[model samples]
Target: MPPDLDPRLTPARPDLADICLRGQVAAERFVEGRPARIAVPSAPLRRRPDVAAGLDTEAVMGDAVTVYDVRDGFAFAQIVRDAYVGYLPEAALGPADPAPTHRVAALRTFVYPAPDLKRPPIAHLSLGAAFAAQAREGEYWQLASGGSVFAGHAVPLGHTEPDAAALAERLVGTPYLWGGRTTLGLDCSGLVQLCLESAGLVCPRDADQQERALGTALPPGLDGLCRGDLVFWKGHVGMMLDAERLIHANGHHMAVAVEPLAVAVARIAEKSFGAVTSIRRLAMTAELAETGAFTPSAAS
Candidate 1:
């Protein structure tokens, strides 16, 4: 089997088989229910149908999810973006909207009660959260939810950032949180996903899934590492800032930090993470690099 195809890359959620990834139950059971859309700025995707369960990931506002079952005020569903199966509170979902106009481009922004900035904020939105625009005020975009966000902090649906690596640099000091994907806190895969998604590249929600879904594998070794290269170890990943340094949201530091590649390798191994498992690079042309238009090749 190809190295990237290792079964460990895909999470095994056997306990959720009837309602999750495997979908062992009959389709008719879920197909009859209407598809739901995320209504809040962000909702926790949990391992079980309870608030106390571990968070598996987060679904942003306007993201679609197919509801399969509901129990104890929770909805068991699969996120449309990455097909991740989890349970979310029923309150987090509402009638679906097939079209969304813009996505949050800033690390974090407030949703104002009115178009005026002086008005108190009604809610907060994180980067990559989709917003449906109803109208444009002088300096804000009025949302269908009756909240207004700064116009400059959002971009049209299809807009892509020029450099993902450069974008990741902005989160250098963010606190690390397991299963988080926001500026307030984030994990290794969350860092990569946020950075690459901002560049209009599709990315999965976990380090292993990301390893299997993005970029071409490079020959093993540290000799040819470059900016934007993805370096992977068991259950963890980091991006190369250049040939010799890497940045990652790590437990060791409990924050996103940059460290010498050699030092990081030794430290991780000392903690029994094992050696580097793979190195992958996104292919880009000199012109694309200059223009900041990165097109990541799907994993092979």
Candidate 2:
């Protein structure tokens, strides 16, 4: 019942009776062990920042995280039947499907976020949210989890998709935090991820997380990036709204603001005292959200 509730995660299940799943079910298909959704009375369950794997199964001393509000990584219903709760690196409460999904994918984000710590945003997903995905690189159907790429185990977003641009615009003025992804505040990649997830596009939680979502990386020069394209500087990420302009929720700007792409680059270059890392486009689909996806070559 409940897709893959293996009675392990659901220790209360009548079927398990004497079976001790330790308040969780076994990992079957997309199911995973996660904290039960209930209201808590005290401090939240904040895992170690370096927490690698065995998250759901680790020791829980105090009250478990009830009333889910994770904003960093995906959470599951069980450590191993409820697969990935959101499949993206962010969660609030209630369902994640918003703005009316236009596409959906069954991709559980744990496939990517779990393995790529640099791309943690993919971990913030909720139970039963809208999923939107399409065929990408002929194999994995790209899901929009925050703003990155993640490899997963045989899952696909369901068909009812939502408008990505509309979703992206909704979170336009959200603030930027080094590692935040919520309406209260968010970083560049966080904004991108939440915006896309709102549209049912499951994505990862990092700038590099954006690479596969776009299918291919743009050549490293500024000339290769176009309007709506994204650029990455080591840990930093921004969106190229036009040839000369980009928008992002940057700590430098202290909020979600727009500036010339070159100016931002100059600032970061000046700050880091080194060469910019790389430049990339927003997910290929977003271009359709603007110029109908027929953008001219940036080389022009």
List, in order, the clash count of every candidate structure: 1, 64
Clashing pairs in 1: 162-292
TM-scores for every predicted model: 0.86, 0.47
Q: Residue by residue across 46-86, what tens digits does model 1's lDDT show?
A: 88777888877888887888776777899877777777877
The superposed Cα distance between candidate 1 and the true structure at residue 257, in angstroms, equals 1.2
Q: Give residue 209's error in model 2 in angstroms.
A: 3.5
What overall lDDT, based on C-alpha atoms, would model 1 receive against the true structure? 0.80
In the range 222-250, model 2's lDDT, one tens digit per residue, is: 87456556677676677665566677778
Residue 162 CA displacement from its true place in model 1, Å? 1.2
Off by over 4 Å in 2: 1-45, 49-172, 211-214, 272-274, 282-300
